[model samples]
Target: MLALSHYNSSASPLFPHFSNDSAGKLEARVTVEGVTDQPNFSPGQPTTGGVIVVILSMTLGIISNIVALIILANAYSLQRRRTKATFLLFASSLVVTDFIGHVIPGALVLRLYLSGGVHHEDSNSSDRMCQFLGGSMVFFGLCPLFMGCAMAAERCLGVTKPLLHSSLVTKTRTKICLCVIWLAALCVAMLPCFQLGSYTYQDPGTWCFIKVLSDTEEVDVAFVVLFSGLGLTSLAVALVCNTISGLTLVLARLRRKPGSHHSAKSHDIEMVVQLVGIMVTSCICWSPLLIFGLMTVIHSYTRSIGDDLLQYQTLMVMGVRLATWNQILDPWVYILLRRTVLRKIYLITKCQAGLRGNMLGRWEPTSFPSSEKNEVNQV
Candidate 1:
């Protein structure tokens, strides 16, 4: 139990303070400042429940991400097609991002727990760690959503217009696009440093994030809205692109025009299925947190002071837990849902159908045409 009651009046190292603390232009303060008055300030005691959950989530996420990366690397090496290689490269990058997301933030949380929660002293060193942790959360959290959207768009183009895709999209261009996605996420994460919004330690002192309901309600609302809006938009784009790709593939399969390459069609189907799985996983796992963020900000906008503090805290914690699951479940989408797996399933189903037909033939009399009867007798 660290206990010290001291206040400081210096500019936040992580972000700048507003020159004028007007109603609209409020200061963007980082949560690590030990400001007891702030809504997001840590209570200085680490909850056993929060610690246990973080440990379990971190452990599973790290192991899963590592295995997914290994699987992706093997696939990438085996791929003969440049298009496939590019997709694999994007997949490998997403896994690496998730892996780091778990390792870096998890390590920080563990360190905070071991140190007995937030320090009493308001020092530069303490602020730096919190800033790093918050920034890591933002960067890693957004990368998967953005990456999924990009993958969906790429596959949609490839399936809908192969000639255009081949002519315009290349390995170099894909790599550059990936870098741009990463850069965009990094920029959003660093926005707090520019005083657009602020990062603060959340309840139980286990994690840090954008301040949801702060004194500077306008800035807080804007930042939260920005983060959540980006996530929702990415998910929406992924949804549309995947739907178009899936429909295109289904239509192509239905038509089955002469001279169409079965192998290529199968490849497109597999890719689209995998992309859909990713899109669904992202929506299920991340929507809660993103939506919760939007709601929280909206609620803050409507109400200056919160009436149900406990409820808000509980919801935030639950939202964070759900969002963390995205990384853990993402890799398995590719591992389990693949062309080889689907082929095996199809074979089993076909065998079962054949066996049932044979059993029925032995139990019930069946009539055949004279030509079929003659053919059977000849055989």
Candidate 2:
């Protein structure tokens, strides 16, 4: 098992962002046999193959997220649609979170590796940086989780209580809700910044993460249970809520009258389905990682499990990295489901091509009658 005390020592710079304890000193030592001494196996120690994967994932994620952002920003017609605007806004926020949570962090890890695996030292600046990065990661990570819940709820309202949805789900109201979601996530992420035991660098020269439990067996077990339990519980709630909402929308659509209005309703159903698909995909990708993360915390706390080192490391690595694919996948979701965005992109491309072609062509202006000539002819 990993020893909490071993990680807390001064020599390792895994978490250079937190301050040393009141002793104003750190003991630096390297242990070779135990979990504490084991390679962290996070982005810090990413193999050459892993680095290539990270680069590809981050590049794709950033580009896709940027496209999603542009779709939300420029497609005014899409914004005017009722539930679409709300969904688009949430989607945009999710993209932002994904960029921060995955791409930026991945880049930092790459930079660290390039610098000879030197860890950040615990200093005032490092502590602040840790607080910022950790806080942002938590905030963005949770945003999509909750926003999925919100999107689900909105679909439920639109289906089960169309009148109410029509009255309540306005652009301004959605903006307010989005703001609230962000604020709540920020609050959750920031809780550790103010407390000492709440945040720590994982090691002197490795990844920084939340300190779930100490090296003590009892504490480690409890810590694992806490984080795992919370993550599972949240996953359950989100899944249930989204499922119910999706069903409600489907049922409502079945009862609608046939016409252009019905066709529009069908489109709405498809959009909801796509959104639900995104939500479900996200849940699947994240849930296992959360469970494993919690388990690691528990196992580390107990110090009883020794042979599970490789398994634990694999789980941790998978949990952190796999969640990133959601960002890369989001742009495809928008393109597949959003007609307005597609139309606008097509029009813009066509206009650009036309202009270029005209510029390349040897062209002459067509002669037309002048205003004076036209007036004399008429007289």
Per candidate, the number of residue pairs that clash is: 1, 17
The sequence of per-residue lDDT tens digits that candidate 2 reaches over residues 1-379 is: 0101112222223323334552324333222133454443322332465456556676777777787778766754434566666667667776676666666556655554444343433223236545555555456666777777777677767767878999989878888988888787777666665442243344333334455322434433443454445446656766676677677755654554332133345445555766667776777766866776677776666654365665665566556555556566756676566544333444456557785444222111101112243433333
lDDT score, candidate 2, position 153: 73
- The candidate scoring highest on lDDT is 1
Location of the lowest summed lDDT over 10 successive residues in candidate 2: 1-10
In model 1, the Cα lDDT at residue 125 comes to 23
lDDT of 1 by residue, 1-379 (tens): 0111211223223333544544442342332232323444334655566567667777777778878888889878878776677778888988888888778887887777756666324323237777888888889889999999999999989888888998988889988998999999999999888888877766555577777644446877888888999999999999999999999976765566433346656567677888888889889878988887777667656653344544565677667777777888887877787665555554455457775543223211111112243433333
Can you tell me which runs of candidate 1 are displaced by over 4 Å?
1-38, 41-52, 119-126, 257-261, 350-379
Candidate 2 — which residues are off by over 4 angstroms? 1-48, 76-79, 118-131, 196-206, 212-234, 256-261, 339-379
TM-score of 2: 0.68
How far in Å is the alpha carbon of 101 misplaced in model 1? 1.2
Give the candidate number with the greatest TM-score: 1
Q: TM per model?
A: 0.78, 0.68
